[model samples]
Target: MMRAILPTRALVPIAGLWRVTACMAGAALFLSACGATTGGPGVTPGPASPVVGAPPEPAVLGVEMSPERLAFTPPHLEGMDLVRVGVLLPFSGASAALRSEAGHLLRAAELALFERGIENVVLLPKDTEGTARGAEAAAEAAIADGADMIIGPLLAAEVRAVSGPARRSNIPVISFSTDTSVAGGGVYLLSFPPEEEVRRVVSYTAALGADRFAIVAPATPYGQLVSQAYRSAAAEFGGTVTAEEVYSGGVDSMSQAARRLARAGIGSLEVGRALAMTGEDWRPTDSGAFQVVMLPAGGDDLRMLAPSMLFADIDPLLVKFVGTGLWRNPDSAREPALANGWFAGPDAEMRARFETAYEIAFSEQPSRLAGLGYDAASLAVVMAASEGGIDRAVIEDPNGFLGVDGLFRLRADGTVERGLALYTIRRGQFEVLDPAPVRFGPDSMAVDVEPGES
Candidate 1:
């Protein structure tokens, strides 16, 4: 008989009702479900924050459990080999925000097992408590418990903590953290990387004749990363960056950068015309020239800077506003100035299906990061059922694996590559500008269509 060892910490059951249904295609499982539940006092609830080199303790909310769970232990079958997978998450304490949707995440993974009909595998949960020390301890414990592979420890710090232990035990780890710096040494990152997002958008935009690009980003570390990615992608995509500007994240600095961007000959004709029509004192110091202006920031930051561009007489129609995956928000559409702006992100169709299934399975919307768990577990299931059984070669397959977010693969360097699609803000919604490729093409980007397509 299979045994499940629940965490010792008391966790109130999540309040709601959910119905789960699995879509099976041979050994692959796709989930579709119904229902919704808003979090209550007994559960951690918030958006996940980024974790860099080190993360300080953060305020936390109560941790809770769902009354229902997909069976992680498969039914016993004669002569079947058993595969053990471990999941590490922040179940309680300060870092709980990183895994506020643990219940939904677990359910999604379970749905994967159920749909695949893989009964010989077992998934064990370990609480990392949202700390590096906790992650190390949990990893050691999980490995002692006979886990053949490990799924997650949400934050980068936790992943770093668990990496040592996992490597020592010769066990592979698939982390959900987006921090690419922590990846490598048998630790495969399943989280989407900003580099991939930048490359996709840049390449696609360049193909469309928007070869002259300019970037305005914040001066933070993430901003630095984005700047580097923009430069690299520009070169790779045969694009020329006429100007690059970094600001200190202040309104004044952003406004000044906008002034400088306007002087770089970007959309000069339209800028002059718009200024003429506005009858404003503002005049183009130099003819604005770049066809594309990439803003690697989003949210209120974008909202703040977007208008500044127009104030500088940069016409929206003359210059295409390009951004990173951060621009994938409905609110971005509400910004009249950014209506036709483009960004790169996962496929919307797949995201909707996954979200619906998660709500139905746990009676609550899954965390934005929950798909990481589902995809990691799904890959684990697929590998476990294969003849090699989670071999290193299998995990590093360049062809990648299809998940709710679309096609993604792990690289030899432990980085992740996702097949992202281009999207544009249209009518207060994001519309697909280019479908995410399902397979790799000769250009090292995702193919426009699946194999055997006309």
Candidate 2:
């Protein structure tokens, strides 16, 4: 199940259906092209089998891709002074199921080098098979091959396994896992975290005079993370949590929770209308308790919960709705109640541009995670060509790099900080409410005026 095409030099191997073809671009440049195939492995026939060729899972903050759009190409470098880059990915064993997705990631990295025409860099892709042991073996093999840097091992467990080896060798590893626990010790996490999203959006809303906040989250691990993030962000951003509620993933639990939260600012009449079955008389409060309510859910869950809040006598116009990166979906924008709601996420325009370029060059669509490969490789190329190649100071630039998603920088603790923009849900779309800051500072430019300023 492997194929190789050697034009002038042996290029990297890509799994799945791809045909290698090359055409000379210039005297010093050559383009090794590959034809993309949309048809994937057919579903196994059995009672337990899922519907054959069902649509793939919905991608975050991006359009759903059809099989008709899948394509790929392997990049080959041509030069004397080679900057060896070790790429650790799950290419075999149990993780072999993800080979198709991994192919797209590798293609993205190749596209970065091809676009930059970085002839001096050579990519060595190793198979981790998506396990801790596999990751360890891959790292050892990569180090033995003299890789100057490592750029993958997608899962947090895999990253953890490679961290010790990578640190011991003094070879910096930039991982794709979002789990911050695995970060540090020469391994950088490039994946987006919910806590960071909460910090950014909550801070933006708090700066807008929202002194009080409330959170309604599911009783799940992710919900707990968002809950903690809201608490921490509210304190840091000059706000307080007026009320917090966690509910099981259902309408009844959420409705009950909403009723309790609505009681914070509900009048006697509104209370009776919303909770007539309570059989207990209620009176009005200050009505100025919480200025904003955050729901860290998305898709159908959000669509249902938003209306439940309205049904619970909480006026959307009075208390603004705030959400996390989950609200960046196209479906969420269509919710009438979500209009004017704010959330923090990547720059959609730039991300769209990258997707378009990817589709055109590879004749295929890319997954959301593909952006990491491109960004990581781009960072390596820039650093490799700099005065001190891959210098710690250079990679950890405080000013950050302008990526496809927007501005981002690596921290000393191996955590990534992105300059994410605040977006407002509009009618069937999302509008940029506050442009992301270019750098980390109080004086950074904001698209809108400061809170309470006319």
Candidate 3:
């Protein structure tokens, strides 16, 4: 049996609908639902301003229920409508790390429910066990329990497995998979697609007069996707990829690929000699084969690749370095070769607030993907109380919705468009070069097809 935890005070409704507000650590975060617009900092309902020593207070909208207790059945409330949102995750899996990530996602979803203070919607969690078969079973169970919509089933394979069941039942699925192939029809991807990140970084670089570009990427599927995105984005920005290299195996292979890419872009021997003489302060007077080189690797691979570029005489000062969201790590900041490199990611300031709130709510740092859960659940809450309800048109609203991860909108094709910010690595830290756009414009909507999209 499930119990409804009623709010201590009644919420004052806005326009006959409950508005979502997250009061965190002395500040109020006003969030807009799909198709609605609010004014503020990064976009409308901008960066939250501090309320001068005020304590945190949860939003009072309606009754709240524990997700654990309402795992399968939601309690019936007389004269009140209930929206059942099925949350599919790999709660029980062979890999312990995946299971832990699943826990973080669930907790994040629950946090959104608590913060939004919406009692009309119930989150019904079902375990996928990290397999396609398990995902199908989970979807079946969730549907049987009268779920109006579904969230998650993380991997691309699991999303595909659940797609059929969800489509037949006319239930929309907001999955966490970055794979664009499974995105479209009734299933939407809420994950961060590398294509968008690549387009953002490339567009920013190109706008700064970088016409010639090069790339040294891994030979994996992820590498292929990013590499294709690089080509499309460069072309879209009126730039050309002059040199490209792919590598597999260990450090030696990566070094060789980096060497080949650097040598291909290196100027004449006289120029190299002059650069060597200038030492650490060297800046080439002439342009090389390419003005920018994109290294889409991160972590240890990035550490190795950066130095390898130096060994091949690829001066970071001469040729600009660019990367995707993978370069947004603290370790990447420490790499000397990546010091002036640029990358595109979410609004750092807003993301920091979310991290702080999550840590305080859950007593632990959330996984990188946990924001997806928070945003999805938050959207569900707003949609549940929406006059149009959780329909396809509302979910695919061109105006989009604003959440902890900045602003994002689900498209009819099931792809998502996010407002990203540009960051540069400098002095062992990541600094914002360009703030994320507060609102999406006509130009922002005109993006090229993703890797797997036709």
Best by TM-score: 3
Q: Residue-wise lDDT of candidate 1 within 1-454, one digit each (tens)?
A: 1000111122222221111111111011111121211111111111223222321112122223333322222222225566777777777737445556554565566655544445566566667778898788767666654678888877899999999988987889998887888999899888878889889988887776666778888988788888888889988877777888888967789999989888876544545665655221222232356767788878888888788778877776667777887887667779877877788998767666667655654556887777787787777776776798977787887767667787788898899988899888877778887898777656444333221100
Which residue pairs collide in model 1, if any?
A: 33-357, 34-360, 37-363, 74-119, 265-287, 265-288, 265-289, 266-288, 266-289, 266-290
Quote the positional error of residue 13 for candidate 1 in Å.
21
Give the clashing residue pairs of candidate 3, or none. 39-45, 40-45, 40-46, 41-46, 42-438, 43-438, 63-119
Instruction: Please give, for residues 1-454, the per-residue lDDT of candidate 2 as tens digits.
Output: 0000001122222211121111111111211122212111111111222232222321111012232312111233222456667778776637444776666776677666655445566565666778898788777766665577888989889999999888988999988998888998778987778888899877876666677889899999888889988999999988888898878968888899898898776433355554553211122233556877899999888998888888897766567788989897899999987877888988676566567656755667898889888888878887778778876676777666766676677899999998798888766788898887655666443222111100
Ranking by TM-score: 3, 1, 2
Q: How many backbone collisions does model 1 have?
A: 10
Q: Residues 1-454, candidate 3, lDDT per residue (tens digit)?
A: 1111111233222211111222221111222222112111010011234233322222211112222222232112324577778788887767999798887887677666655456676666677889998888777767765678899989999999999989988999999999999998799999889999999988887776778889989999989999999999999999889999998967899889988887675764466665565222323244788877888989999988878888888877777788999998889999987887888998766666567666765457989999888888877876787797788887887766655667678899999888899888768888888898756765334322111100
Candidate 2's C-alpha runs over 4 A off are 1-79, 93-97, 265-286, 441-454
Query: For model 1, what is the alpha-carbon lDDT of residue 106?
Result: 58
Q: Each model's TM-score? A: 0.76, 0.76, 0.79
Give the worst 10-residue stretch by lDDT in candidate 3: 37-46
In model 2, residue pairs whose N, Cα or C atoms come closer than 3 Å (at least 3 residues apart or on different chains), thus clashing, are 71-364
Give the distance in Å from residue 291's predicted Cα in candidate 1 to where it truly belongs: 2.2
